[model samples]
Target chain A: MTERLTLALDAMGGDHAPAMVVRGAEIARTRYPQVDFIFFGRESEISPLLDRMKKLKAVSRIVHTDEAVSSDDRPSVALRNRRSSSMRMALDSVKEGAAKATISAGNTGALMAMAKFVLKTLPGVDRPAIASFFPTLRGETVMLDLGANVQCDARNLVQFTVMGNAFARSVLGIKEPTYGLLNVGSEELKGHEILHEARQELSGLNLPGRFHGFVEGDDITKGTVDVVVTDGFTGNVALKTAEGTAKLYTEFLRGTFRSSLLASIGYLLARPAMRKLLKRVDPRRYNGAVFLGLNGITVKSHGGTDALGFAHAIGVAVDLARNGCLETMGRDFKAVDRSTPDEPAQAAAV
Target chain B: MTERLTLALDAMGGDHAPAMVVRGAEIARTRYPQVDFIFFGRESEISPLLDRMKKLKAVSRIVHTDEAVSSDDRPSVALRNRRSSSMRMALDSVKEGAAKATISAGNTGALMAMAKFVLKTLPGVDRPAIASFFPTLRGETVMLDLGANVQCDARNLVQFTVMGNAFARSVLGIKEPTYGLLNVGSEELKGHEILHEARQELSGLNLPGRFHGFVEGDDITKGTVDVVVTDGFTGNVALKTAEGTAKLYTEFLRGTFRSSLLASIGYLLARPAMRKLLKRVDPRRYNGAVFLGLNGITVKSHGGTDALGFAHAIGVAVDLARNGCLETMGRDFKAVDRSTPDEPAQAAAV
Candidate 1:
């Protein structure tokens, strides 16, 4: 595990390309010396940052690609015209088995699309989902379909649930991750037909993890289930809402501390624990955007991220790769088929 | 205006019963002398609390009733069986023009059911929604359909949208409340079929507020939308997620501050500002739950609430009564015909 982790850093991607990406790569090298990185943008963009990165660790490879993927570049267009782009070539490297994983901080849609296209789906995976760990009241909750597969069908959602469970167990180290459908309510008949249908489909699937019935937004915070599954729209909304509220709450708390002279001193005394908690819940620390259901490990860092964020993304990729996530997922899917082929109509009833 | 605000309090319902109800009434009376109260419940439950209430404030009347509605009781059954129950009778007081509004910390379904039965829907209003205000990062956002109509059609959602718009304006004093349909994304085409239909309906309707397209859960915290409209299930999820996350965040902050000595001192200095924020965002201060789509003003406080929470509910009721909320809603509904004069296809489509 301490051995070198070769990561193809898509330096040309992200808003603060090259600089932040290069810095993040350097950080990853120093903190995790076992992890070696390749800078994948144009030589001009990567050269200046080389000095800063030298302070942390030396880079082994520099795949010079003149092409860069702008945040605004259309995904299809990027894939078509910029086949030689750094992001594309980085994935090509991963495909060629040069790197264990490829990391990018570019347009999520484009990255996911290209990643899916290049990596392809593993056996039995209809599609890949993006699952992330959120800081909730109870504990970390894994939510899927944050921005992948927006208009998903019942089968799509059921698969999302399966992938999510596999993810929580593999990455988060949870055993038998509890899976729950994210809906407006818990009642079997409460939400729309899709979720209702999904509930039925899930009921009969004989999934590897425990099906904890349906959960709502608050349920995410309650930690009622380990893996919460939903379509990208609702899941994305829930994730962003939690993130925004966390930031807002932090801002308000700091201001409250500074308002009064005495309270200001109290805030000073409480800074250590407070900062710890803030960072604990900071969305950036959990900076991982996993392309689930894919044949290979592709992690997308936040586009507007800092050096530290990219390092975290690499950490996530390392975890996924070492954990045999794909193999485990295939096993889970096989379990579904082997356990219950009948799938009684009444078995899926809400 | 404060002097004229009188509220009828339901004593028999809720999880805590007469003690919390009597305590809440006393607290409201002490805080707002303009506020008078009439307690309706079993005489046995009210007699003992009269002297204690007198110690806090003067009680004008106590209407004796033997029936009580359980939280799980069906709305219709509760409404029928509890013909003279405290909740129904209190609502009757509001309908008969004796009190500005009736407040219940009881079964939410029964409260809405009885209110609708006795007070009736406002002209042109097809359905009523449950609405509450959330303190967001920017300022505040109003969310509706917390749990009113579980299985809402596009039409019901439209009505919820209408109610949310008026509530934001009247209660929050917001001008041209920015309305957003809570969905996964901002795209016009994204969402469940009902939501998709409602999106079109909302876009086409010439309403009082500005429809700023579809707002996601994060938009609530971003302060992009003044009114976040959703079905009861989604609304409840969003609201509860906000609530649970806020609590968890504060808890984490508290733990962080308490972890070490130096940070503890920092917490002291920042205590005033933090206290101000905690006060402003405190859930209890914004406890009153308004039942929209009713002919008269009504508020549902949390079943397990204190005097402060009840006082907030009274404050909400006072605002609605003073602002002619019922009349405004009636006028808005009049502008949009509830019953279709034609277009059977439209109704079916809706």
Candidate 2:
């Protein structure tokens, strides 16, 4: 527990890049004092920012990489051409055992492709899933396959369930998490054929977490389960829809506060309370999207996030790394893979 | 436009049942003075409720039906056995041309099933889609296939686009409404094979509204397009996710307002402005889910909505009937059917 953990940061990634990465490392250093960093980017750009933060500079070193993956680069194009890019190099650090994890805010597709190529998937996992925690009424729920595998089979969903369960136990510190498959309805007869196959497979397995069967999209915000597993297509849409609704709500509040003199006065009086609520539901708190089921940990930060948000992403990587989430998933999924030896009911394959 | 329109009501449906139906009809009577209602349920229950509202009784007549579709009844069970159900009678009225449309707050599956069997789909439409309008930043956006078809092919998606476009123009009064296919990403090559096929088909067709290509889930609330088309599964999940997020925001607001005495005073002063915001985003304002592509209009109200919400649903049916939405859709689909005669690229069939 006292051992120092090193995290690789893609210093040239995101909107604010090197500055945000350096400042974020400084903020994270205070919270996780045992954590160190390897910043990957052009030293000329990163060095200046690091020089301003002595605390981060003390435990961090720069790995020079002139090339960086552009935000618009496709996964295949980035993987083939941008081999020496900051994002790829950062992931390489994790593969090379120079760091416990990698954190990046670059192109999501490029990051995923590079991470998979460099670190590889765990023994029992067919694909890596993007897992993130969402704030709900009761607490937080971790949903996986946010946008990784668009066309997931029953096996992929089961693997996601295993990965998400491992995530909850390792990072969230839940002794035994409860998981559910995200569907249009909670009925046993709901959703695609693959979902039913996945449910049947999960029901047969003696997993660490309890399987709650099918749950609707509303169950994510209701905190009905610790983990919600879904295909990347639906997960991505659901996540974005929730984000959009939240933004719309904020806009409505702003318009309300500006409508009249009394409302303006009211906003001023309620500023303190409103600040507390804002902090509680702040997107920055949930900025990190963890690439689960990989041999090495990789966290994707929101591209437009500030230093504080990047720091949150760093904390997520640190938590997953420290808790040995990869190993936990490996062990749990090994048992599942043994029980379910054949992947016969692959609807997509048919 | 000057003709008096009649809407059939499933008076024994919903959580509130005959009482809410009678009250809602009274409210709608005031709004649409030329609209009349034929209440289908037990006359003993309907007569007593209508007696309390003289205005509703003046323009409405009760059609006694002993049987009613239970909330828990499966679609197949309801369709086979519940032949004399109030919901069935309501649809029957529409088929008999006794009512211009049917308004039901009953089981959604049962309503859709009965409506399809009684009224049938419009010519050239293989399946009907659930269409609803969402409150968006720019105004309102019409989205289709909310929960009707769990699995849809490219042809189904193209048909949904057609229905949604007609809905926007005829009901929402949007001239040349722009539409987008909901996908994981806005990129050209993002989602499943079906999405690609659907996009290709939409692109080639000379649609009533302009096709804006793929749109992410967030675009729905952003009002990026006037209409959105997706399979029922994804659409249902996204819609529910947005609703859940909205509910969470309200809970957060309530918690903030009750956190301190200053906040309580602020809330009192801000009540008027908050009311305005609430009214604008009210679920009641968007209560009706229309079954598009049907030969006749069928509006389904939220089963748990109050009198006001039910009244809003009635308004939806009235609007659709008055605007000849079914005929408009029929005309639009006829052109699409002629152009896209062969459904050769149906991935689901393969």
User: For candidate 1, lDDT tens digit of each residue in A139-189?
Assistant: 788889887766678888988888888888888888777889987652322
Query: In angstroms, how far off is B6's CA in candidate 2?
Result: 0.5
Task: List the lowest-lDDT window of 10 residues for candidate 2 chain B.
Answer: B340-349
Which residue runs of candidate 2 sit more than 4 Å off their true CA positions? A186-189, A338-350, B186-189, B340-350
Instruction: Quote the positional error of residue A161 for candidate 2 in Å.
Output: 0.5
Residue A65, candidate 2: alpha-carbon lDDT: 88
Go through the candidates in order and give each one's DockQ.
Answer: 0.51, 0.61
- Model 1 TM-score, all chains together: 0.90
Write down the TM-score of every candidate.
0.90, 0.96
Winning model by DockQ: 2
Model 2 in CAPRI terms: which quality? medium
Model 1 Cα shift for residue A239 (angstroms): 0.9
Over the true interface, candidate 2 deviates by an RMSD, in Å, of 2.0
